[model samples]
Target: MDEGRPIFQQIAERVENDILSGALVEEGQVPSTNEFAMFYRINPATAGKGVNLLVEQGILYKRRGIGMFVATGARERITARRRELFVLEYVAPMLAEAASLGIEPDQLGQLITDQLTAGRLSEKETR
Candidate 1:
């Protein structure tokens, strides 16, 4: 969880992570806002805000009388969204920095490959 962001966002990300990691499958039951509050020691409203974010994103859905459930294709949606975010948030910056440093595109690609081959890059970089 990123402390720099709002707690609600972090909570939403935790749920997304669970979904991405296969801990929360499509159509699977998710804990209620109250349960989330109890488990994370956060206010119920805060937890609800997080859960609601997922609901808004179509990654989760309410069951009226029951609690939430993972929406169909939620994992794929989350993965696609995260990949887009990664490019905008990480890849773009790396490319911009490399350009500023006069690093050619091919050179940067080779550098990335070399790092991967040498196991110098982190897991995220390899990805």
Candidate 2:
């Protein structure tokens, strides 16, 4: 739980992460709001609010008497939305900072590749 963000938003993102990670599949039933509340030690209404956020976004659906389930194409929808956010939140800022530092696009690309290679090497060493 991040103290900087709303608990409901965190709850919603946790579910989204689970779906994206394939831990929650399309049409698979999700835990009830009460279960979420108990697990997170939060109010049931707060948990429901988070779950309802996904429902409103068409990422989840209810089946009358049954519990909530992941919506069809939810993974693709989440991926598309996240990619857009990534560009806006990360890529745009990175480009702005690079420009401010007089780093050309080619230099930035090389820097990124270098960092990726370093990261891979570090991961191998840790294994």
Task: For each candidate, give its TM-score against the true structure.
Answer: 0.91, 0.92
Worst 10 residues of 1 by lDDT: 117-126
Best-fitting candidate, measured by TM-score? Answer: 2
Error of 1 at 43 (Å): 0.8
lDDT string for model 1 (1-120, tens) is 467889999999999999999999899999999999999999899999999999999999999998899999999999999999999999999999999999999999999999887785
Clashes of each: 0, 0
Q: After superposition, how far is residue 3 of candidate 1 from its true place, in Å?
A: 3.9
lDDT of 2 by residue, 38-116 (tens): 9999999999999999999999999989899999999999999999999999999999999999999999999999999
Write down the RMSD of candidate 2 (Cα, Å).
1.4
Q: Report the Cα RMSD per candidate.
A: 3.9, 1.4
